[model samples]
Target: MTDLHFECTGARPEPFGASPTLLFGLRIEESDHQPVHAIALRCQIRIEPVRRQYEPEEVGMLGDLFGEPSRWSSTLKPMQFAHSSITVPGFTGTTDIDLPVPCTYDTEVASASYFRALSRGEIPLLFLFSGTVFTGRNGFRAEPIPWHKESSYLMPVDVWQQMIEEYFPNSGWLRLRKDCLESLRRYRSQRALSSWEQVFQELLATAGAKGGD
Candidate 1:
């Protein structure tokens, strides 16, 4: 059996990807210095929210997801970020690979909301690894990678911000129900609103007036 170790060296935004993507640099090593036929690797990435501190503004933004700060001890749990897989070609002793993690700007997602709330500092991440390892000295052999295999990484917040900015510059995404969308469209048409932003601005002004009264 090959004793394998995994490490996340760093991460960066994928410039040419069709969608928003993050490439994590992964390093894998074999203890016995044997020839590996290939590895079918599956990774589950999680965000450990409890591992980092939050700002006052961030807390306000996170209220919908985790509730109030007073109740955070129970609410602030690990959130699933992504599940990704890669097939590493045969290598001797050690090798490096990029794990492409597809990302979304949809703020309705818990992970995306949490990420957007952060102002600064690293996001604590836990990577759980599993899959099959094909290796042998003489011929092809297969072994199950242990379930206990895991790694931790502190991904810089700026990296995520940069990626989002590159794709959505000065904009954010929101998901609404079909009925609500149709209503907004009707409202916009009735008012002859040239853009969605204008429609939202008018609605907010109306809401503010109603609140004041």
Candidate 2:
């Protein structure tokens, strides 16, 4: 019967990951100073919408995810951000480890949309922890971590934006339906467009000229 305390000290962008990632500094302390062998940790991270205020522009950008500002009282709720698992090495009383969380820029996801909408400030995040904890003199005991173990952290929005910029670099991504993509490909091929940007610009110009007439 050991009680564990979790705290997130800070976060930073991972340098050499395949996808964009943020590594959070996690400190875990056990109530009883027993020799723990390891922890098979699983954490559910949530974005708490009501924990922070939003700018007018942010609210406008986030309307698609949470609806209008007027309706936020009902709509403002925790959003599932990510789920990550790690094997925390054993310690006597306390230990610090890196909690790596994979991130995406897919606007279709509510968490990603919410993150993109924010210009500045901290993101209120809740980490719910569960799994098996191994302990004892020779790693003899195994027990289940309590369900109520949770921790809150305010992650700087700038950190997330910076990480995204590092990977995307002044660009955005979108996933199109196969049929729509095929149609766009055909359009591009018909005009011998060199790039998708050009194809889109040509379409916009054609639409504008038609509207002018």
Candidate 3:
């Protein structure tokens, strides 16, 4: 059995991708001098919300996901961030690979909302690794990568924000029902509203007026 060590060095925003993505740097080092042919690795990344403190505003933003902060004991659980896989080419003692973690801006996704709730500080992350490892210099032998092999990294919040900004600058993402969007579009046409923002403002104004009445 080959015992490989896993280390999460850090992460940064990917320069170019079809969508928002983060490139995590991982180092795989072998204890013995035995050469590693290749590694077919699958990584499951999770956000450890319970591992970090939340600000007042952040608490409010996360209320929809976790409910009241008082109930966080049961609510603040590890959320799935991304599931990614990569093939590490053959290497000797140590090898580094960039794990691409794609992201979405859809607020309906708890992961996206969880990320948006964070403004500053580091995000505690847990990376669970599993897969098959091929070893030997002359010939390759297959072995299962240890299931317990894992690593943790505190990723800076700015890295996420920067990636989002690159793809969704000065914008926020939301999902609306087809009928609801049609209704808003009809309202916009009727009132000659220029944008969806105007329609939302009008609705808020009307709701406030009714509340005061």
Candidate 4:
């Protein structure tokens, strides 16, 4: 059996990734100073929303996900952010690896919406780790990594913002049904709307006028 420890030192935005991605610094340590042949590490990252305080504006934005602020006591629960895996090469004592976590800008996703709602402060994250550990002095022996292997890290909100900005500058993603998209397209064609922004603006103005009536 091997005793393994995990820690998330920091995180940063992946500049050259094809999509919005975050790289979390993962440090793994072997307690007994044993030579680890290899490791197939799988991690489940979760956002612990109850661990941090929310601003008034943030609370308002998060209403759709967590409901009213007063109901947050019960509604605020951990949300899954990403599930990622990495192959760790053999090491004797310890090793550091980059955990690549692919992210999406779709506002329909709970994690993305929660992240967008945040203005500042760190996001409390819980990393649950599991996988196979290959180790032995004479030869390689396969063993299961304990389920209790977990770590907690406070990721700065700015990092996420930076990643989003890099991938989508001054823009946001909204997923709509096929029928709704067709309807929007027809509306845009009929009105000769040059851009989606203009279409949305026109619709909002019309809605406001109707509301005042």
For model 3, give the 10-residue run with minimal summed lDDT.
Answer: 30-39
For model 3, how does the per-residue alpha-carbon lDDT over 99-196 read when each residue is reduced to its tens digit?
99988999889899898989899999999999999997678799998889999999999999999998889888679999988888889999999988
Per-model TM-score on C-alpha atoms? 0.97, 0.93, 0.95, 0.98
Candidate 3, position 18, lDDT: 90
Model 2 CA deviation exceeding 4 Å by range: 204-213
The candidate, 2 or 3, that scores higher on lDDT is 2
Sort by lDDT, top down from the best: 4, 1, 2, 3
State the lDDT of candidate 2 residue by residue for 11-47, as single tens digits: 9999899999999999999988988899999999999
Q: Which of the predicted structures, 1 or 2, would earn the higher lDDT when compared with the native? A: 1
Report, for all candidates in order, the number of backbone clashes. Answer: 0, 0, 0, 0
The parts of candidate 4 lying over 4 Å away from their true place are none
Ordered from best to worst TM-score, the candidate numbers read 4, 1, 3, 2
Candidate 2 residue-pair clash tally: 0
Q: Which ten residues in a row have the lowest lDDT in candidate 1?
A: 165-174
lDDT (Cα, tens digit) per residue for candidate 4, span 63-168 = 9999878898999999999999999999999999999999999998999999999999999999999999999998879999999999999999999999999999
Q: What is the Cα-based TM-score of model 2?
A: 0.93
